[model samples]
Target: MPGSITGTIVDPTGAAVAGARVRISHGDQSAEQEALSGDDGQYSLPNVTPGPFQLTITLVGFTTQASSGILRSGENYTVPQIAMPLATAVTEVRVVPSRVEVAEDQIKAQEKQRVLGVVPNFYVSYDHHAVPLAPKQKFELAWKTTVDPVSFGVTGAIAGIQQAQNDFSGYGQGAQGYGKRFGASYANFVASTYIGGAILPSLLKQDPRYFYKGAGSKRSRVLYAIANSVICKGDNGHWQANYSSILGSLAAGGISNLYYPAKNRDGAELTFENTLIGISESAAVNLLQEFFIRKLTRNIPNYEPVSP
Candidate 1:
Protein backbone atom coordinates (compact mmCIF):
# COMPACT_ATOMS: atom_id res chain seq x y z
CA MET A 1 0.00 0.00 0.00
CA PRO A 2 1.16 3.48 -0.88
CA GLY A 3 0.83 6.63 1.20
CA SER A 4 1.51 10.32 0.65
CA ILE A 5 3.20 13.11 2.62
CA THR A 6 2.45 16.84 2.23
CA GLY A 7 4.11 19.88 3.74
CA THR A 8 4.86 23.58 3.32
CA ILE A 9 8.07 25.64 3.56
CA VAL A 10 8.13 29.14 5.02
CA ASP A 11 10.53 31.65 6.50
CA PRO A 12 10.40 33.01 10.00
CA THR A 13 8.60 35.99 8.52
CA GLY A 14 6.02 33.46 7.36
CA ALA A 15 6.63 34.39 3.75
CA ALA A 16 6.18 31.66 1.20
CA VAL A 17 9.54 30.45 -0.09
CA ALA A 18 9.09 29.41 -3.70
CA GLY A 19 11.72 27.41 -5.58
CA ALA A 20 12.97 25.84 -2.34
CA ARG A 21 14.39 22.39 -2.98
CA VAL A 22 12.60 19.76 -0.85
CA ARG A 23 14.04 16.27 -0.62
CA ILE A 24 12.53 13.16 0.99
CA SER A 25 14.34 9.84 1.46
CA HIS A 26 13.39 6.59 3.16
CA GLY A 27 16.03 3.89 3.58
CA ASP A 28 17.33 2.06 0.46
CA GLN A 29 13.78 2.16 -0.90
CA SER A 30 13.99 5.97 -0.81
CA ALA A 31 11.98 7.95 -3.32
CA GLU A 32 13.17 11.49 -4.08
CA GLN A 33 10.66 14.06 -5.32
CA GLU A 34 10.92 17.88 -5.44
CA ALA A 35 8.05 20.30 -5.14
CA LEU A 36 8.44 24.05 -5.64
CA SER A 37 6.29 25.83 -3.15
CA GLY A 38 3.63 27.95 -4.76
CA ASP A 39 3.23 31.59 -3.82
CA ASP A 40 1.25 30.18 -0.92
CA GLY A 41 4.34 28.11 0.13
CA GLN A 42 2.40 24.86 -0.21
CA TYR A 43 4.28 21.74 -1.36
CA SER A 44 2.82 18.24 -1.67
CA LEU A 45 4.44 14.89 -2.49
CA PRO A 46 2.10 11.97 -3.13
CA ASN A 47 2.21 8.17 -3.67
CA VAL A 48 4.92 7.13 -1.24
CA THR A 49 5.14 3.62 0.23
CA PRO A 50 5.72 5.11 3.64
CA GLY A 51 8.02 3.61 6.24
CA PRO A 52 10.96 5.24 8.08
CA PHE A 53 11.51 8.52 6.23
CA GLN A 54 13.51 11.74 6.49
CA LEU A 55 12.60 15.09 4.94
CA THR A 56 14.97 17.90 4.04
CA ILE A 57 14.59 21.32 2.45
CA THR A 58 17.28 23.65 1.07
CA LEU A 59 17.04 27.15 -0.25
CA VAL A 60 19.56 29.72 -1.28
CA GLY A 61 20.02 32.35 1.43
CA PHE A 62 18.36 29.87 3.82
CA THR A 63 19.51 27.16 6.18
CA THR A 64 18.81 23.51 5.44
CA GLN A 65 16.20 21.74 7.58
CA ALA A 66 15.96 18.01 8.11
CA SER A 67 13.29 15.93 9.86
CA SER A 68 13.15 12.23 10.70
CA GLY A 69 9.75 10.60 11.08
CA ILE A 70 7.77 7.40 10.64
CA LEU A 71 4.90 6.91 8.28
CA ARG A 72 2.39 4.05 8.19
CA SER A 73 1.77 2.41 4.78
CA GLY A 74 -1.55 3.32 3.17
CA GLU A 75 -1.95 6.26 5.54
CA ASN A 76 -2.10 9.83 4.35
CA TYR A 77 0.24 12.01 6.42
CA THR A 78 0.72 15.72 6.86
CA VAL A 79 4.09 16.86 8.21
CA PRO A 80 3.84 19.83 10.47
CA GLN A 81 4.49 23.02 8.44
CA ILE A 82 8.27 23.31 7.98
CA ALA A 83 9.94 26.54 9.00
CA MET A 84 13.38 27.18 7.47
CA PRO A 85 15.67 29.60 9.22
CA LEU A 86 17.23 32.36 7.19
CA ALA A 87 20.86 31.90 6.24
CA THR A 88 22.94 34.79 7.56
CA ALA A 89 23.55 37.45 4.92
CA VAL A 90 26.66 38.94 6.52
CA THR A 91 29.13 36.30 5.40
CA GLU A 92 27.89 36.43 1.82
CA VAL A 93 28.16 40.21 1.68
CA ARG A 94 31.67 40.09 3.20
CA VAL A 95 32.88 37.85 0.44
CA VAL A 96 31.95 40.38 -2.22
CA PRO A 97 34.45 43.16 -3.14
CA SER A 98 32.29 46.01 -4.44
CA ARG A 99 33.77 48.53 -1.98
CA VAL A 100 35.67 50.62 -4.47
CA GLU A 101 32.88 50.49 -6.97
CA VAL A 102 30.48 51.56 -4.28
CA ALA A 103 32.76 54.44 -3.29
CA GLU A 104 33.11 55.56 -6.88
CA ASP A 105 29.35 55.55 -7.21
CA GLN A 106 29.04 57.64 -4.05
CA ILE A 107 31.72 60.04 -5.19
CA LYS A 108 29.90 60.50 -8.45
CA ALA A 109 26.81 61.32 -6.48
CA GLN A 110 28.75 63.75 -4.26
CA GLU A 111 30.23 65.60 -7.23
CA LYS A 112 26.75 66.92 -7.87
CA GLN A 113 26.38 68.77 -4.57
CA ARG A 114 26.16 72.35 -5.71
CA VAL A 115 24.88 75.67 -4.33
CA LEU A 116 22.36 78.04 -5.99
CA GLY A 117 22.99 76.23 -9.25
CA VAL A 118 26.28 78.11 -9.51
CA VAL A 119 28.71 78.01 -6.57
CA PRO A 120 30.69 74.85 -6.05
CA ASN A 121 29.54 73.18 -2.89
CA PHE A 122 31.26 69.96 -3.85
CA TYR A 123 32.65 69.22 -0.42
CA VAL A 124 29.26 68.68 1.14
CA SER A 125 27.88 65.15 1.20
CA TYR A 126 24.11 65.12 1.41
CA ASP A 127 24.37 61.39 1.82
CA HIS A 128 24.16 60.43 5.46
CA HIS A 129 25.07 56.99 4.22
CA ALA A 130 28.43 57.91 2.73
CA VAL A 131 31.22 55.38 2.57
CA PRO A 132 34.84 56.09 3.48
CA LEU A 133 36.76 57.57 0.60
CA ALA A 134 39.96 55.88 -0.48
CA PRO A 135 43.25 57.83 -0.42
CA LYS A 136 43.18 58.22 -4.17
CA GLN A 137 39.65 59.58 -3.94
CA LYS A 138 40.73 62.17 -1.38
CA PHE A 139 43.46 63.41 -3.70
CA GLU A 140 41.10 63.41 -6.64
CA LEU A 141 38.63 65.63 -4.82
CA ALA A 142 41.45 67.95 -3.71
CA TRP A 143 42.76 68.21 -7.25
CA LYS A 144 39.26 69.01 -8.43
CA THR A 145 38.95 71.86 -5.93
CA THR A 146 42.45 73.20 -6.61
CA VAL A 147 41.95 73.44 -10.34
CA ASP A 148 38.39 74.69 -10.27
CA PRO A 149 38.03 78.05 -12.00
CA VAL A 150 35.88 79.28 -9.13
CA SER A 151 38.69 78.44 -6.76
CA PHE A 152 41.05 80.69 -8.70
CA GLY A 153 38.46 83.44 -8.77
CA VAL A 154 37.94 83.22 -5.04
CA THR A 155 41.69 83.30 -4.45
CA GLY A 156 41.95 86.40 -6.63
CA ALA A 157 39.37 88.12 -4.46
CA ILE A 158 41.32 87.25 -1.30
CA ALA A 159 44.48 88.63 -2.87
CA GLY A 160 42.66 91.87 -3.58
CA ILE A 161 41.56 92.05 0.03
CA GLN A 162 45.09 91.45 1.34
CA GLN A 163 46.38 94.27 -0.85
CA ALA A 164 43.61 96.49 0.44
CA GLN A 165 44.68 95.79 4.02
CA ASN A 166 48.44 95.88 3.27
CA ASP A 167 48.49 92.44 4.81
CA PHE A 168 51.98 91.51 3.54
CA SER A 169 54.12 94.63 3.85
CA GLY A 170 57.26 92.59 3.20
CA TYR A 171 56.29 92.41 -0.47
CA GLY A 172 55.84 96.24 -0.56
CA GLN A 173 52.82 98.03 -2.08
CA GLY A 174 51.34 98.20 -5.62
CA ALA A 175 51.04 95.59 -8.38
CA GLN A 176 54.09 93.61 -7.23
CA GLY A 177 52.79 93.31 -3.69
CA TYR A 178 49.35 92.48 -5.02
CA GLY A 179 50.80 89.74 -7.22
CA LYS A 180 52.95 88.43 -4.37
CA ARG A 181 49.98 88.42 -2.05
CA PHE A 182 47.97 86.62 -4.69
CA GLY A 183 50.59 83.90 -5.02
CA ALA A 184 50.94 83.59 -1.26
CA SER A 185 47.23 83.65 -0.70
CA TYR A 186 46.56 81.10 -3.40
CA ALA A 187 49.38 78.93 -2.13
CA ASN A 188 48.01 79.19 1.39
CA PHE A 189 44.57 78.18 0.23
CA VAL A 190 45.97 75.33 -1.81
CA ALA A 191 48.27 74.14 0.94
CA SER A 192 45.67 74.30 3.66
CA THR A 193 43.09 72.67 1.44
CA TYR A 194 45.24 69.91 0.03
CA ILE A 195 46.98 69.20 3.32
CA GLY A 196 43.98 69.40 5.57
CA GLY A 197 41.37 68.24 3.13
CA ALA A 198 43.30 65.66 1.18
CA ILE A 199 46.97 64.84 1.82
CA LEU A 200 47.07 64.86 5.61
CA PRO A 201 43.52 63.58 5.85
CA SER A 202 44.48 60.59 3.76
CA LEU A 203 47.67 60.10 5.80
CA LEU A 204 45.98 60.60 9.15
CA LYS A 205 43.11 58.37 8.06
CA GLN A 206 40.45 61.06 8.27
CA ASP A 207 37.55 62.09 6.08
CA PRO A 208 37.93 65.62 4.71
CA ARG A 209 34.38 66.31 3.55
CA TYR A 210 31.73 67.70 5.85
CA PHE A 211 28.94 65.20 6.56
CA TYR A 212 25.77 67.23 6.39
CA LYS A 213 23.48 66.51 9.31
CA GLY A 214 20.53 68.43 8.00
CA ALA A 215 18.13 67.54 10.78
CA GLY A 216 17.26 67.83 14.43
CA SER A 217 16.22 70.79 16.59
CA LYS A 218 17.85 74.19 16.11
CA ARG A 219 20.06 73.80 19.15
CA SER A 220 21.15 70.35 18.12
CA ARG A 221 22.15 71.50 14.64
CA VAL A 222 24.12 74.41 16.07
CA LEU A 223 25.96 72.20 18.53
CA TYR A 224 26.58 69.56 15.88
CA ALA A 225 28.30 71.91 13.45
CA ILE A 226 30.42 73.49 16.18
CA ALA A 227 31.47 70.11 17.47
CA ASN A 228 32.37 69.04 13.94
CA SER A 229 35.16 71.60 13.45
CA VAL A 230 37.18 69.92 16.19
CA ILE A 231 35.97 66.41 15.41
CA CYS A 232 35.65 64.88 11.98
CA LYS A 233 34.73 61.75 10.08
CA GLY A 234 37.55 59.25 9.90
CA ASP A 235 38.56 57.23 6.88
CA ASN A 236 36.63 54.42 8.49
CA GLY A 237 33.53 56.63 8.31
CA HIS A 238 33.51 57.43 12.00
CA TRP A 239 33.74 60.71 13.87
CA GLN A 240 37.09 61.27 15.61
CA ALA A 241 39.20 64.14 16.97
CA ASN A 242 40.08 66.52 14.16
CA TYR A 243 43.86 66.52 14.54
CA SER A 244 44.15 67.20 10.83
CA SER A 245 42.32 70.54 11.06
CA ILE A 246 44.05 71.74 14.24
CA LEU A 247 47.53 70.85 13.03
CA GLY A 248 46.90 72.02 9.48
CA SER A 249 45.74 75.41 10.65
CA LEU A 250 48.77 75.77 12.91
CA ALA A 251 51.14 74.76 10.15
CA ALA A 252 49.62 77.23 7.71
CA GLY A 253 49.74 80.03 10.28
CA GLY A 254 53.40 79.43 11.03
CA ILE A 255 54.26 79.31 7.36
CA SER A 256 52.36 82.57 6.72
CA ASN A 257 54.35 84.40 9.42
CA LEU A 258 57.51 83.72 7.39
CA TYR A 259 56.34 85.86 4.48
CA TYR A 260 54.66 88.68 6.43
CA PRO A 261 56.64 91.75 7.54
CA ALA A 262 58.63 91.31 10.76
CA LYS A 263 56.55 94.03 12.39
CA ASN A 264 53.35 92.29 11.21
CA ARG A 265 54.45 88.76 11.96
CA ASP A 266 52.63 86.71 14.58
CA GLY A 267 55.39 85.29 16.85
CA ALA A 268 55.61 81.60 17.81
CA GLU A 269 53.36 82.36 20.76
CA LEU A 270 51.20 84.48 18.48
CA THR A 271 51.13 81.64 15.97
CA PHE A 272 49.80 79.30 18.60
CA GLU A 273 47.37 82.00 19.66
CA ASN A 274 46.33 82.41 16.04
CA THR A 275 45.74 78.69 15.78
CA LEU A 276 43.39 78.97 18.76
CA ILE A 277 41.73 81.93 17.11
CA GLY A 278 41.36 79.86 13.97
CA ILE A 279 39.48 77.17 15.82
CA SER A 280 37.18 79.70 17.42
CA GLU A 281 36.70 81.31 14.07
CA SER A 282 35.78 77.92 12.69
CA ALA A 283 33.12 77.57 15.34
CA ALA A 284 31.66 80.87 14.28
CA VAL A 285 31.72 79.80 10.66
CA ASN A 286 30.18 76.49 11.62
CA LEU A 287 27.44 78.35 13.40
CA LEU A 288 26.79 80.25 10.23
CA GLN A 289 26.83 77.00 8.29
CA GLU A 290 24.28 75.55 10.64
CA PHE A 291 22.06 78.62 10.65
CA PHE A 292 22.60 80.50 7.41
CA ILE A 293 24.62 78.94 4.59
CA ARG A 294 21.90 76.61 3.37
CA LYS A 295 19.46 79.44 2.92
CA LEU A 296 21.96 81.66 1.13
CA THR A 297 22.75 78.78 -1.16
CA ARG A 298 20.52 76.76 -3.50
CA ASN A 299 20.57 73.70 -5.75
CA ILE A 300 21.78 71.63 -2.82
CA PRO A 301 20.91 68.04 -3.59
CA ASN A 302 18.09 66.58 -1.56
CA TYR A 303 19.88 63.36 -0.71
CA GLU A 304 20.07 64.37 2.94
CA PRO A 305 18.11 61.61 4.65
CA VAL A 306 16.00 64.13 6.50
CA SER A 307 15.31 67.86 6.70
CA PRO A 308 16.35 70.26 9.46
Candidate 2:
Protein backbone atom coordinates (compact mmCIF):
# COMPACT_ATOMS: atom_id res chain seq x y z
CA MET A 1 0.00 0.00 0.00
CA PRO A 2 1.23 3.49 -0.75
CA GLY A 3 0.81 6.68 1.21
CA SER A 4 -0.18 10.09 -0.14
CA ILE A 5 -0.03 13.66 1.18
CA THR A 6 -2.84 16.16 0.59
CA GLY A 7 -3.79 19.61 1.87
CA THR A 8 -5.31 22.99 0.98
CA ILE A 9 -3.46 26.32 1.11
CA VAL A 10 -5.12 29.67 1.76
CA ASP A 11 -4.32 33.34 2.14
CA PRO A 12 -4.37 35.09 5.52
CA THR A 13 -7.92 36.26 4.64
CA GLY A 14 -9.02 32.58 4.23
CA ALA A 15 -9.34 32.81 0.45
CA ALA A 16 -7.96 29.79 -1.46
CA VAL A 17 -4.44 30.30 -2.81
CA ALA A 18 -4.30 28.97 -6.37
CA GLY A 19 -1.05 28.06 -8.21
CA ALA A 20 0.91 27.50 -4.96
CA ARG A 21 3.77 25.01 -5.04
CA VAL A 22 4.04 22.44 -2.25
CA ARG A 23 7.39 20.67 -1.75
CA ILE A 24 7.59 17.66 0.54
CA SER A 25 10.70 16.05 2.11
CA HIS A 26 10.83 12.93 4.25
CA GLY A 27 12.40 12.74 7.70
CA ASP A 28 14.64 9.97 6.28
CA GLN A 29 16.38 12.68 4.20
CA SER A 30 14.97 11.18 0.99
CA ALA A 31 14.41 13.12 -2.26
CA GLU A 32 11.64 15.66 -2.32
CA GLN A 33 8.42 15.63 -4.36
CA GLU A 34 6.31 18.58 -5.51
CA ALA A 35 2.65 19.27 -6.37
CA LEU A 36 0.83 22.38 -7.48
CA SER A 37 -2.30 23.70 -5.80
CA GLY A 38 -5.44 23.52 -7.93
CA ASP A 39 -8.03 26.27 -8.32
CA ASP A 40 -9.56 25.05 -5.04
CA GLY A 41 -6.12 25.41 -3.34
CA GLN A 42 -5.99 21.62 -2.86
CA TYR A 43 -2.72 19.74 -3.59
CA SER A 44 -2.06 15.99 -3.59
CA LEU A 45 1.21 14.08 -3.80
CA PRO A 46 0.21 10.46 -4.57
CA ASN A 47 2.44 7.48 -3.64
CA VAL A 48 4.48 9.58 -1.27
CA THR A 49 6.79 7.45 0.82
CA PRO A 50 5.25 6.83 4.24
CA GLY A 51 7.23 8.66 6.94
CA PRO A 52 7.51 11.90 8.87
CA PHE A 53 7.77 14.78 6.43
CA GLN A 54 7.91 18.52 6.02
CA LEU A 55 5.96 20.57 3.49
CA THR A 56 7.00 24.01 2.12
CA ILE A 57 4.31 25.98 0.29
CA THR A 58 5.36 28.95 -1.80
CA LEU A 59 3.84 31.42 -4.31
CA VAL A 60 5.21 34.42 -6.12
CA GLY A 61 3.56 37.20 -4.11
CA PHE A 62 3.03 35.33 -0.82
CA THR A 63 5.32 34.43 2.08
CA THR A 64 6.44 30.80 2.22
CA GLN A 65 4.59 28.55 4.67
CA ALA A 66 5.61 25.18 6.15
CA SER A 67 4.04 22.25 8.00
CA SER A 68 5.23 18.88 9.33
CA GLY A 69 3.47 15.59 9.99
CA ILE A 70 3.83 11.80 10.10
CA LEU A 71 2.13 9.57 7.50
CA ARG A 72 0.81 6.00 8.03
CA SER A 73 1.12 3.31 5.33
CA GLY A 74 -1.67 3.35 2.73
CA GLU A 75 -3.22 6.37 4.40
CA ASN A 76 -4.38 9.56 2.74
CA TYR A 77 -2.66 12.09 5.00
CA THR A 78 -4.51 15.40 4.89
CA VAL A 79 -2.43 18.14 6.50
CA PRO A 80 -3.92 21.23 8.18
CA GLN A 81 -4.61 24.13 5.86
CA ILE A 82 -1.61 26.39 5.37
CA ALA A 83 -2.03 30.15 5.55
CA MET A 84 0.23 32.43 3.46
CA PRO A 85 0.94 36.07 4.28
CA LEU A 86 1.18 38.66 1.50
CA ALA A 87 4.77 39.43 0.49
CA THR A 88 6.07 42.80 1.61
CA ALA A 89 8.60 43.16 -1.21
CA VAL A 90 8.16 46.05 -3.58
CA THR A 91 6.50 44.93 -6.80
CA GLU A 92 5.66 47.98 -8.86
CA VAL A 93 6.11 51.76 -8.85
CA ARG A 94 4.10 54.27 -10.89
CA VAL A 95 4.92 57.95 -11.31
CA VAL A 96 2.13 60.12 -12.65
CA PRO A 97 3.08 63.54 -14.01
CA SER A 98 0.99 66.51 -12.91
CA ARG A 99 -1.70 67.60 -15.38
CA VAL A 100 -0.32 71.11 -15.68
CA GLU A 101 3.16 69.77 -16.29
CA VAL A 102 1.81 67.41 -18.92
CA ALA A 103 -0.05 70.23 -20.66
CA GLU A 104 3.05 72.38 -20.63
CA ASP A 105 5.11 69.61 -22.21
CA GLN A 106 2.47 69.09 -24.88
CA ILE A 107 2.41 72.82 -25.57
CA LYS A 108 6.17 72.90 -25.92
CA ALA A 109 6.05 70.13 -28.50
CA GLN A 110 3.17 71.80 -30.36
CA GLU A 111 4.94 75.14 -30.43
CA LYS A 112 7.79 73.56 -32.38
CA GLN A 113 5.53 72.46 -35.23
CA ARG A 114 5.66 74.64 -38.31
CA VAL A 115 4.82 74.08 -41.97
CA LEU A 116 8.04 73.68 -43.92
CA GLY A 117 9.81 74.90 -40.79
CA VAL A 118 8.51 78.42 -41.30
CA VAL A 119 4.76 79.01 -40.98
CA PRO A 120 3.50 78.34 -37.43
CA ASN A 121 1.06 75.45 -37.12
CA PHE A 122 0.21 76.08 -33.50
CA TYR A 123 -3.58 75.55 -33.43
CA VAL A 124 -3.78 71.81 -34.01
CA SER A 125 -3.41 69.08 -31.37
CA TYR A 126 -2.23 65.79 -32.79
CA ASP A 127 -2.65 64.13 -29.40
CA HIS A 128 -6.18 62.82 -29.08
CA HIS A 129 -5.91 62.86 -25.28
CA ALA A 130 -4.29 66.26 -24.97
CA VAL A 131 -4.87 68.09 -21.71
CA PRO A 132 -6.94 71.29 -21.76
CA LEU A 133 -4.96 74.52 -21.96
CA ALA A 134 -5.16 77.02 -19.13
CA PRO A 135 -6.49 80.52 -19.95
CA LYS A 136 -3.06 82.10 -19.60
CA GLN A 137 -1.56 79.42 -21.85
CA LYS A 138 -4.26 80.04 -24.45
CA PHE A 139 -3.44 83.75 -24.61
CA GLU A 140 0.27 83.00 -24.76
CA LEU A 141 -0.20 80.74 -27.78
CA ALA A 142 -2.25 83.39 -29.63
CA TRP A 143 0.38 86.00 -28.91
CA LYS A 144 3.15 83.75 -30.22
CA THR A 145 1.22 83.02 -33.43
CA THR A 146 0.44 86.67 -34.15
CA VAL A 147 3.98 87.85 -33.55
CA ASP A 148 5.84 85.15 -35.47
CA PRO A 149 7.90 86.66 -38.28
CA VAL A 150 6.05 84.63 -40.89
CA SER A 151 2.74 86.20 -39.88
CA PHE A 152 4.06 89.69 -40.68
CA GLY A 153 5.61 88.50 -43.93
CA VAL A 154 2.39 86.79 -44.99
CA THR A 155 0.37 89.92 -44.21
CA GLY A 156 2.76 91.99 -46.31
CA ALA A 157 2.42 89.53 -49.19
CA ILE A 158 -1.37 89.70 -48.97
CA ALA A 159 -1.27 93.49 -49.06
CA GLY A 160 0.92 93.39 -52.16
CA ILE A 161 -1.55 91.01 -53.83
CA GLN A 162 -4.46 93.31 -52.95
CA GLN A 163 -2.48 96.26 -54.39
CA ALA A 164 -1.76 94.39 -57.64
CA GLN A 165 -5.38 93.32 -58.04
CA ASN A 166 -6.65 96.80 -57.00
CA ASP A 167 -9.14 95.07 -54.66
CA PHE A 168 -9.66 98.20 -52.46
CA SER A 169 -9.56 100.96 -55.04
CA GLY A 170 -10.84 103.67 -52.68
CA TYR A 171 -7.40 103.55 -50.97
CA GLY A 172 -5.85 104.34 -54.40
CA GLN A 173 -2.80 102.52 -55.88
CA GLY A 174 0.33 103.83 -54.08
CA ALA A 175 2.52 103.26 -51.02
CA GLN A 176 -0.35 104.64 -48.92
CA GLY A 177 -2.74 101.98 -50.27
CA TYR A 178 -0.25 99.21 -49.44
CA GLY A 179 0.23 100.46 -45.89
CA LYS A 180 -3.54 100.68 -45.28
CA ARG A 181 -4.11 97.18 -46.70
CA PHE A 182 -1.26 95.73 -44.63
CA GLY A 183 -2.55 97.30 -41.41
CA ALA A 184 -6.09 96.09 -42.07
CA SER A 185 -4.91 92.54 -42.84
CA TYR A 186 -2.77 92.33 -39.71
CA ALA A 187 -5.58 93.77 -37.61
CA ASN A 188 -7.94 91.15 -38.99
CA PHE A 189 -5.49 88.40 -38.05
CA VAL A 190 -4.89 89.66 -34.49
CA ALA A 191 -8.57 90.28 -33.67
CA SER A 192 -9.83 86.93 -34.98
CA THR A 193 -7.00 84.96 -33.34
CA TYR A 194 -7.39 86.62 -29.93
CA ILE A 195 -11.20 86.57 -29.89
CA GLY A 196 -11.62 82.98 -31.09
CA GLY A 197 -8.46 81.19 -30.00
CA ALA A 198 -7.86 82.88 -26.66
CA ILE A 199 -10.61 85.07 -25.14
CA LEU A 200 -13.71 83.09 -26.08
CA PRO A 201 -12.04 79.74 -25.54
CA SER A 202 -11.00 80.82 -22.06
CA LEU A 203 -14.43 82.19 -21.17
CA LEU A 204 -16.47 79.33 -22.61
CA LYS A 205 -14.07 76.60 -21.43
CA GLN A 206 -13.93 75.27 -24.97
CA ASP A 207 -10.84 73.98 -26.75
CA PRO A 208 -10.04 76.14 -29.75
CA ARG A 209 -7.43 73.83 -31.23
CA TYR A 210 -8.45 71.36 -33.91
CA PHE A 211 -7.91 67.74 -32.86
CA TYR A 212 -6.56 65.52 -35.58
CA LYS A 213 -8.38 62.25 -36.23
CA GLY A 214 -5.57 60.22 -37.73
CA ALA A 215 -7.12 56.78 -37.82
CA GLY A 216 -10.15 56.23 -40.02
CA SER A 217 -11.22 55.55 -43.57
CA LYS A 218 -10.40 58.36 -46.01
CA ARG A 219 -14.02 59.41 -46.38
CA SER A 220 -14.63 59.34 -42.65
CA ARG A 221 -11.55 61.42 -41.92
CA VAL A 222 -12.57 63.94 -44.56
CA LEU A 223 -16.06 64.20 -43.12
CA TYR A 224 -14.73 64.51 -39.59
CA ALA A 225 -12.37 67.29 -40.60
CA ILE A 226 -15.18 69.21 -42.28
CA ALA A 227 -17.54 68.62 -39.35
CA ASN A 228 -14.98 70.07 -36.94
CA SER A 229 -15.48 73.51 -38.47
CA VAL A 230 -18.90 73.54 -36.78
CA ILE A 231 -18.14 71.31 -33.78
CA CYS A 232 -15.25 71.33 -31.30
CA LYS A 233 -14.21 69.67 -28.07
CA GLY A 234 -15.08 71.40 -24.83
CA ASP A 235 -12.69 71.57 -21.89
CA ASN A 236 -14.92 68.93 -20.32
CA GLY A 237 -13.96 66.64 -23.21
CA HIS A 238 -17.37 66.63 -24.86
CA TRP A 239 -17.94 67.76 -28.44
CA GLN A 240 -20.11 70.87 -28.87
CA ALA A 241 -20.98 73.50 -31.46
CA ASN A 242 -18.02 75.78 -32.29
CA TYR A 243 -19.63 79.01 -31.17
CA SER A 244 -16.28 80.68 -30.45
CA SER A 245 -14.99 80.30 -33.99
CA ILE A 246 -18.24 81.25 -35.73
CA LEU A 247 -18.83 84.34 -33.60
CA GLY A 248 -15.17 85.34 -33.79
CA SER A 249 -15.26 85.32 -37.59
CA LEU A 250 -18.31 87.58 -37.63
CA ALA A 251 -16.80 89.92 -35.07
CA ALA A 252 -13.51 90.19 -36.93
CA GLY A 253 -15.35 90.89 -40.18
CA GLY A 254 -17.41 93.65 -38.51
CA ILE A 255 -14.28 95.19 -37.00
CA SER A 256 -12.53 95.20 -40.37
CA ASN A 257 -15.18 97.58 -41.85
CA LEU A 258 -14.16 100.29 -39.37
CA TYR A 259 -10.60 100.46 -40.69
CA TYR A 260 -11.13 99.76 -44.39
CA PRO A 261 -12.05 102.55 -46.87
CA ALA A 262 -15.73 103.58 -46.73
CA LYS A 263 -16.29 102.13 -50.21
CA ASN A 264 -15.00 98.74 -49.00
CA ARG A 265 -17.32 98.39 -45.99
CA ASP A 266 -19.15 95.05 -45.89
CA GLY A 267 -22.92 95.27 -45.61
CA ALA A 268 -24.75 93.04 -43.15
CA GLU A 269 -25.43 90.46 -45.86
CA LEU A 270 -21.83 90.60 -47.01
CA THR A 271 -20.60 90.22 -43.43
CA PHE A 272 -22.63 87.05 -43.02
CA GLU A 273 -21.37 85.83 -46.38
CA ASN A 274 -17.82 86.37 -45.18
CA THR A 275 -18.57 84.40 -42.03
CA LEU A 276 -19.76 81.48 -44.13
CA ILE A 277 -16.63 81.82 -46.22
CA GLY A 278 -14.51 81.78 -43.07
CA ILE A 279 -16.19 78.57 -41.91
CA SER A 280 -15.61 77.05 -45.35
CA GLU A 281 -11.97 78.07 -45.19
CA SER A 282 -11.67 76.40 -41.79
CA ALA A 283 -13.02 73.19 -43.23
CA ALA A 284 -10.54 73.33 -46.08
CA VAL A 285 -7.67 73.99 -43.67
CA ASN A 286 -8.76 71.11 -41.47
CA LEU A 287 -8.81 68.82 -44.45
CA LEU A 288 -5.28 69.84 -45.29
CA GLN A 289 -4.23 69.31 -41.67
CA GLU A 290 -5.65 65.79 -41.68
CA PHE A 291 -4.08 64.62 -44.93
CA PHE A 292 -1.18 66.91 -45.68
CA ILE A 293 0.13 69.38 -43.07
CA ARG A 294 1.53 66.94 -40.53
CA LYS A 295 3.94 65.63 -43.12
CA LEU A 296 5.16 69.08 -43.94
CA THR A 297 5.26 70.11 -40.28
CA ARG A 298 8.57 69.97 -38.49
CA ASN A 299 9.14 68.84 -34.87
CA ILE A 300 5.72 67.27 -34.22
CA PRO A 301 5.41 64.87 -31.33
CA ASN A 302 4.97 61.14 -31.85
CA TYR A 303 1.88 60.68 -29.76
CA GLU A 304 0.25 57.32 -29.08
CA PRO A 305 -3.47 56.85 -28.60
CA VAL A 306 -4.55 56.29 -25.02
CA SER A 307 -7.52 54.26 -23.83
CA PRO A 308 -10.60 56.19 -22.77
Candidate 1 has an lDDT of 0.78
Best by TM-score: 2
Question: Can you tell me which runs of candidate 2 are displaced by over 4 Å?
Answer: 1-96, 305-308
lDDT of 1 by residue, 144-243 (tens): 8888788888889998988888776787888888888888888878777777788788889998777777788888888888897899888776779999
Model 1 residue runs over 4 Å out of place are 1-97, 261-263, 296-299, 306-308
Tell me each candidate's RMSD, in Å, in order: 12.2, 9.6
Question: How well does each candidate superpose onto the true structure, as a TM-score?
Answer: 0.64, 0.68
Q: Name the candidate that leads on lDDT.
A: 2
Pairs clashing within candidate 2:
none
Error of 2 at 245 (Å): 0.3
